[model samples]
Target: MDTIDREEVDEVCALAEAGQQDYDARFELSRMLLEPIEDEASDSKMIACCKGCDHCCHLRIEAYEFELDSIHAYYLRELNSEQQAKIKEAIVERYPIVKDLGDQEQRSINVRCPFLIDSQCSIYPVRPMSCAGYNSCDDSLCKRSNDDPNDTSFGIPQDQNIGYMKMRQMALVQMALDLSFEEEREIISGMHRRLFG
Candidate 1:
């Protein structure tokens, strides 16, 4: 894919080789893979995702199996005991209802992400690729979409080179899968499992 840089590809493979146990290393690789997509989207003015604009945070977000492990590692390493407990409590409270909702329906629901703390993504640097890929050129459109989930007509101007970005995202996830076994689960449910342990 035109979006896949040879060096970044090599880095992903290297990170995979470093293994899932090295959570920090894997996170570094995720950040590297995401940086280009963010840059390209920003350069194209396609990214209107900003702090305090959490309309999209309610959407269902999934992670590569390895990425989920990384998130758990992040929580343990970065969050205080109280913060961790709070996240767990939120997941326990919300995941059951969310587990039954269809993807689009879940997106329309007003439930905030378990990881969203005070209108900001608490795990932003290592957030899921699905979350990273989301973009909007206009904040109003996002708000409208949130307000009226049935209106699927709302859309943002995506970067023209989205194919490349998609390829990169697939490459990163596939590489992680090759290195570890993980089944895809809804974000809250997955986090609940992780936090429970």
Candidate 2:
């Protein structure tokens, strides 16, 4: 948590430098990989369905070191002093326990993300790829999330949007790379390193 470990930050940067950064070559990687999603995001279906719904925003999410680093780097350069301080305060205040917990505990944040502000994400542009990618369907997961906005339980995955789930595996890789965690903790850090860092 000490500012997104420089090592982790370097991994993604190295990837980018080597030109092997997951989807860095394609600026529209998220939009393309999750293609068809671009239109779906704005289409009446998802737009109308998700209006006034902060289900995904409230759910606990996790981030991979690379993805987290990607976000952190973006924020390091993009945000103003006031904005950075505000997000830092929010992150530290929201995850007070993580702040105190040893590296072990910090690895897995089992609380609502500190990055979430006013129930709406404050950092939308520099948000992690995961954030830009996550989309809830009319599936059981969506139903459960809508029913309990505060629920932290894992939801059922959609048949079509499996890519989102796959990308999430990188989070595990990241955590494993940084902390040799034994238990599967409950914190979620879905992207937005800018707001949540």
**Predicted structure with the largest TM-score when compared to the true one:** 1
| Candidate 2 TM-score over all chains jointly | 0.49
Query: Once model 1 is optimally superposed onto the true structure by TM-score, how far is the C-alpha of residue 160 displaced, in angstroms?
Result: 4.0
- Go through the candidates in order and give each one's C-alpha lDDT: 0.72, 0.46
lDDT tens readout by residue for model 1, 1-197: 35545666677778866756687687787687677676766666455667799988877787766678777888888888877777888898897888788666786665778888888888878787677777777888878877877687756554556536745676655654453213456788778777665
**Deviation in Å, model 2, residue 168 alpha carbon:** 10
**Model 2: runs farther than 4 Å from truth?**
1-15, 18-52, 98-110, 138-159, 162-197
- What's the C-alpha lDDT at position 18 in model 1? 79
- Per residue, candidate 2 scores C-alpha lDDT tens digits across 17-71 of 4433433432232222233333435542432234334556544544434445545
TM-score of each: 0.82, 0.49
Error of 1 at 59 (Å): 0.9
* Cα lDDT over the full model 1: 0.72
